[model samples]
Target: MSIKKCRQEFEKIFKKYPDKTQALLPCLYVAQEKCGCLTEEIVSFLAQRLDLPKVEVYSVITFYSMFSFEKKGKFVIRICMSLPCYLRGSREILEAVVEEALCIKPNQSTEAKKFTIEPVSCLGLCDIAPAMMINKKIYGNLTPQKAREIIRRYKQEKDK
Candidate 1:
């Protein structure tokens, strides 16, 4: 998407918020969706557009694990590493994904650029435990076999 288009989308979202600051998060989300990841150019554009300090925009990106400042694969697989997930065999699930599926460790993207495996602190699915997110979809109560199957489905999707 073009920068002009992004700005237009931001304007639409910005108009809905009573306070300009309240629109920051949603605007950033829209920017990320358009640009894939939050590049420096995108952050600078947002800072200028919102009349906020560039540092403030960068801070929000860094504070939220969901926001990526660097390039990520088409499918970013986020495995939960919080205590609840860990206690429920998330470690094994991670190993299965890394070893049997993508062949890339956490924080690494596959050579084909199809997937990026990341270990996040939480996915807010503690009740289910052992959860992971691929893009915006969450899968919980996972075992190693299920993780592999999910990875397989994504890989197939990439082929399509």
Candidate 2:
């Protein structure tokens, strides 16, 4: 479907919320779901549809790390790097997973076009330290081997 079609669907979601501000998150989510990332064009389109200033939309997008202006890989891998995860050898796990799956450093995508590896601040799963998110699903209590296995499984599922 085209971005215009996505925007029309987003308009329906926006209509459900009593306030335009309340629709921001869902609207952005729909935008990302349709376009894979929030680019300048999408942001401008949102601002126009929501009747908000472009700067307002841009500020909101910039303030949130969850929003991406650039195109992401098919899989967006977020490895937790907060205190608990740090103490739990998250770095090693991150390295192993990235090397094995994407063959690139953190914040890089593989040449094979399969995955992107990134170090995230926290996933609010500190209790499970060394957690990571694949797309939106959280994986906790990760070891280097577990990370590799998870990536393999995800790739297999995506292939299917």
Candidate 3:
């Protein structure tokens, strides 16, 4: 890992927040962008910079679904399972992802590492009930066929 770059990015984000605690999430994002996942080095760096305990850092990261400790596939597909989404046929949406789309189970990545499927409690897109997020983008009001096509298009995208 490039400590210099990491420190530069960390400090850049660190300066944006008056409350250092408010900076924790953005700092973690910078580290994750560089390393693909959080490392022990990142935890130590963040804790030292934020003047917080390592356990505190761990707790914060674990509580947020956006922060991943493990390196995910090229695309992370998060399906919503919240009540609003559930009422809107999210179960069918999940089945579409598993059966018609990637054919991979939740919390597992495809053999080719193209996608990792996850069942998230909520994406806070209640208005777009029955939504799924691929990486940072959201897709909503989906049918099985639409989900399959979406996955096919994503599969065709070259690694960035």
What TM-score, over all chains together, does every model reach? 0.92, 0.86, 0.90
Winner by lDDT between candidate 3 and candidate 2: 3
For model 2, how many clashes? 0
Backbone collision tally, model 3: 0
Query: Which 10-residue span in candidate 3 carries the lowest summed lDDT?
Result: 1-10
Query: Could you give candidate 1's per-residue lDDT for residues 66-105 as a string of tens digits?
Result: 7886668989999999999999999999999999998898
| lDDT ranking, best first | 1, 3, 2
lDDT at position 159, candidate 3? 42
Candidate 2 deviation (Cα RMSD):
2.1
Cα error, residue 3 of model 2, in Å, equals 2.4
For candidate 1, list the clashing residue pairs, or say none.
Answer: none
Sort by TM-score, best first: what order?
1, 3, 2
Query: Given candidate 1, what's the lDDT at residue 64?
Result: 85
The local distance difference test score of each candidate is: 0.87, 0.81, 0.83
Worst 10 residues of 2 by lDDT: 1-10
Q: Write the per-residue lDDT of candidate 3 for residues 11-129, one digit (tens) a residue.
A: 78878886888888989888777776788888888888888899999999998876777877888899998899999888888898888878889888888777888889888888888
User: In model 3, which runs have C-alpha deviations exceeding 4 angstroms?
Assistant: 1-5, 158-160
lDDT of 2 by residue, 1-160 (tens): 2367476878688879868877877888787767777877777777887789999988888776667776677888999888889999999888888777657888776665567787889889998888999888989989999999999997887789
